[model samples]
Target: MKKILTAGAFMTAFFASSAALAACETDVKKDDITAEQATELYECIKEKMREGYGSADAPFSKEYQAWKVTATAPAAPGAHGKRFLITYANETAHGEYVKFSEERADNPMPVGSILAKESFGVTKKGAVKAGPLFVMEKVAKGSADEFGNWVYSAVQPKGKVMKIKQGFCHGCHAAFEDQDALGYPVEEVRLKP
Candidate 1:
């Protein structure tokens, strides 16, 4: 009886630990994110943005870093609903190159710019019920002119000037009316320092 009780206690403890760890792990490749992890990433970006701008006192500059993960819905007729994970940072911008490992030697995608792969709906909070998959790169750099303005641009490797499709942010937010319409993750917004 004593040995049996000890084994049962060990099993309970092991299961509890496993459950806790599972809750903390984020399956980004699967596009499954918990509200807690989403909130943590959101706040990190917000704080970094505030730091880069010195003060929140003027017309807000557009310098920021961000990423989004989207999962698509099933192809069946009425299916709908998707999830999105977006992370952003603000600071003095510098452009980075991007390169894909499988590309041919002649391929022109840069060497290090941050790469983003997004699916439309793998989690309950995602943006699309199911459909498009997007891959984008983000680069931050000071402006070319004398003013030395700041800029953050997301684009495809095929073309340098093509703008990213960030506009979908608004629509996704509207769906989760309780959350920020822009996928801002309100719970993570840090208080101004």
Candidate 2:
């Protein structure tokens, strides 16, 4: 009886720990989640996303974390499938991108500028799932005129390059013509220059 009871206790502990490791969930609704809660969810899953994206051997996927963050926390505005998004700008882009300007005149992202946006979704039950890493790279003028000279691509959460249609991404970006085809983060979360 003593041995049986010990075995049962071990099994109980094992299952409990496993449950804790299975998923990072929240009690709040997805839209109702606060910056603090979003941050907590980010901290819980950042490493997993990094590892998954890093496996692709892409510079943007592996090096984005070292870039300057554009927002204080992940934000949502019904874009990117309504997933929460956090953006990072590489050295070539940080100076100009940080301006967060709204006018396109005299405010184009420079060639070589690369912006990487990391995304994640919260299920109805608030179970956090890592999403893809979307990348936008600016090239020389006329290099990609139809898409504002910006090349769009993505890496799946598991490190596979996603099939991207330039027009598909540019179609939505075109709405932000005044902003040079850029979508700034929600005002409240943007880091001040």
Candidate 3:
């Protein structure tokens, strides 16, 4: 009788732990976009990039929101996958902004050369042969700077199997040092909004 009771308890515990793990693997959905709109959201980013450099007058304000896209993985081993984050400003500003970030299993900051050649298949001459898809997770809130703006945070991709990429920081800074060059300033980009 005691052996039967112990076995029952162990089974219950095992099932409970398995259930928790399964819950952690949540599937990201496409409906998270505000306005349930796509084209209008993408246009917002196009306008901001054209404006050149981020400023108070920038078309997009520092608000928290998320956009979604469909993306693909690379074929070669050790090649980091790419994704795009499309974000929008809330009440503080308007328009959309598009940014590219990546995820890898081993090296976090892979060289741009490897990224261009292996992952993107882009030639050193700056020709893009293939493009990948990505989805925005959502802007994080409660973080702010001295200006009292709502800071934004985004996940590179959406879905259950996504892993955070590494080359995002190095790649963007190297390519667009003037505009998407700088990351959110640490003093202004924390969880203390």
Q: Estimate each model's TM-score.
A: 0.24, 0.87, 0.22
lDDT of 3: 0.26
RMSD of each: 16.8, 4.6, 19.0
Candidate 3 residues 1-193, lDDT tens each?
4555588898998998776444322232223322222222333333333222222231122112222211121122222333122222222122112123222122122111011111122223322222222222222333222211122222211112224343443444334333322222122111222
Q: Which candidate, 2 or 3, would have the higher lDDT against the true structure?
A: 2
- Candidate 1 per-residue lDDT over residues 7-60, each given as its tens digit: 889999899877654543345533345455544333333343334332322222
- Best-to-worst order by lDDT is 2, 1, 3
What is the Å distance of residue 47 in model 3 from its true position?
Answer: 41
- Residues 1-193 of candidate 2 have per-residue lDDT tens digits of 4554588899998997666565478878988989988888887799898899989866578888789899999987789999999999999988888788888756788899999999999988778999999999999998998999999999999999898899999999989998779998999899887
lDDT values for all models: 0.30, 0.88, 0.26
Which scores higher on TM-score, 1 or 3?
Answer: 1
Which candidate number maximizes lDDT?
2
Best by TM-score: 2
The stretch of ten residues in a row with the least summed lDDT in candidate 1 is: 92-101
